[model samples]
Target: MSRVPRIRFKGFEEDWEQRKLGELADIIGGGTPSTLNLEYWDGNIDWYSPAEIIDQIYVDRSQRKITELGFENSSAKMLPEGTVLFTSRAGIGKTAILAKKGCTNQGFQSIVPYSNKLDSYFIFSRTEELKKYGELVGAGSTFAEVSGRQMGNMQLMIPKTIGEQHIIGVLFSTFDRLITLHQRKLEKLKTIKKSMLENFFPQNGEKTPKIRFSGFIEDWEQRKLGEIVKEVNRVDENSNAPVMMITANDGFIEQSERYSTDNAGKSLKKYILLKRWELAYNHGASKIRPFGSCFALTRAANIRIPFVYHCFLALEDNPEFLEHTLNGKNVENQLRKIVSSGARMDGLLNISFQEYTSIFIRCPIRKEQDKIAILIKSLDHLITLHQSKLEKLQKIKKSMLESMFV
Candidate 1:
């Protein structure tokens, strides 16, 4: 790729100059206010630690607060607005610029740029670029850490004029805004789905939900899950079907798609074929209730009729209702009860098909189930789209960071 000439202001050569961070800026470390002294802790000042740097945006507020006494007691000092706060340990290398005056804990090293020599925004971006270098230097250690002195000692190339620095900062800031917008949309979509689930599903024995499809008056029936879906646990060794792996997130997916294998072996048992709209669940994975983990099949797969996948969804009288309920806190509590063991590290939990089938649920009519599923699925699709856009924006920023600086 052809390299663009270093940017510059009028009458300047535009050639980049190399300087140690210490020469261009003052690097300071943050201290923690005493937690024991209530007066020294929750005051007006925003207190930051490495934990607050995950989003990579300029931080206007912190997750914590400290008082003047707390600030004075610790090794940390207050950094002025526009100082760059970089994580030194625990999620090492993430960096953000402070949008308001605040103090941080020992896990961060704040950079304050010298007057007129470099724009704070430009230094923020450059510090981000330097973070990759810090990681390389800090490699082979269990906890990646770089002191304020180390950050100051690192050498960097920069345009001599502040005007050019501000321009580059503005270009990247636009991309950051686009990314943050998509992230907010994704959060909204999830909230909508949660609210709809609570509204549509019958709560604690009210004959009908206050919110339901218009004109549907038939009372939902309470039925055992086993009565609705068959449970197929037969594993035939001779079957040529694809091997499946189940995870908490995606539910069931082809094992081959998730892993690279030089050795492929055929399973002896054939799985019952599954069709679209069928529900599946895993007995092993439970977020709310240990009864089963469930999902509606979006694709056809040759599997069992009582596939753990569908059976997982078959709870809650309606599969759609069950899907949303599974993610709720109540369901999680029930799941904990159904599972035989609390040892997650063992990767084993006992939930019998018989017990699962007998679980009571308030079932809506099939038509209502279809409607609820469609609405929730549509929201899920929107969430997925926004998440994909966010990922793309992040990737674009990553590429630019790699190419724009030396």
Candidate 2:
């Protein structure tokens, strides 16, 4: 195996030492207190489970608390502040160093390093490395578990001086903080978009929303969908036009490498040659509410309307209104009724051209439709920008973990 080189700084040699975990620390596993005994729980003592520790960066708080009675009755041990906690099963291998005194369930093994030799932060980081090693050893097993004995026997390269360990720990902690800040920003942007979608659209019994396009005072007209537009399905095997996919969140895309291209052996010839502004629905998959299952396709075919895709996607008419309403509850219920069980496996909620066209829609003028589309599109762009930044930060963290550790 390759080894890290020793370096000298300020008249001191920083040599890395290879030693078993048991030689440097006391390995302690935990147990769950009986939930039936209410007297054991609901007190001031901090108690942690695997679920609570899985995603924690620092363990300052816990999901549950225990009393003196509970602590005495159970196998749980009160670990002091700065002890390293490592998960053992199920989600397996997550590690966190406690910031305060705490107790843990059987799912974790806490390591209390020998006084002044190893820092808690350095041990926590080493446990993370061991987790990856354990995954490789346990691959193909039905249930992978890392026993306390196995953990104690595992070997790691450690620096003799505590000062060097502290410096390495501080560097990684700074990266973790930056990643967390970007995550919070992404969450805030999502909340804003959700609120705007609800407020800008019509609500129950209010024909016209309080908000309107500038210089437009007309109330929207309620008309049957068939009167204004025609629904056509052209499912041709020979046509090589790109297979478009729809998603609930992203609307439509021309290419989808993530999904299979088979189309489930169903005939696409019956699918309409979608034009600009023409609306389409994925009636078959809408029942289960899968991601990218239902959305308006944006790319235009041979059609005349300017910004046809935006018109269908815009929050203007009752179709737009109906899209939101159907997405919530109505479509799922309606799909359940239409599903047919048979040998052909033709169990899908298909909206017929006649049935879909006959549905009534409340529509604003074309000019107002254009305006609403522009405003919502701007918000969508901002949401996408933040999402990209979050993804990039996550990638950087992953790369650092691979490079920084020996």
Q: lDDT winner among the candidates?
A: 1
Lowest summed lDDT across 10 adjacent residues in model 1 is found at: 261-270
Off by over 4 Å in 1: 1-17, 32-52, 62-78, 89-91, 105-107, 126-129, 132-145, 159-164, 232-244, 261-264, 268-272, 286-292, 301-335, 342-348
* lDDT (10s digit) by residue, model 2, range 289-390: 621133444455522211111223333343334444334333344444544431124433344445544544455677766566566667777778878887
Q: Write the per-residue lDDT of candidate 1 for residues 323-398, one digit (tens) a residue.
A: 5545555445555667676535634456666754555666678788878878888897898899999999989877
Q: Please, what is the whole-model Cα lDDT of each candidate in the order they appear?
A: 0.69, 0.63
Q: Candidates' TM-scores?
A: 0.78, 0.73
Clashing pairs in 2: 233-272, 234-269, 234-271, 235-268, 235-269, 235-270, 236-269, 247-292, 277-308
Q: After superposition, how far is residue 406 of candidate 2 from its true place, in Å?
A: 2.0
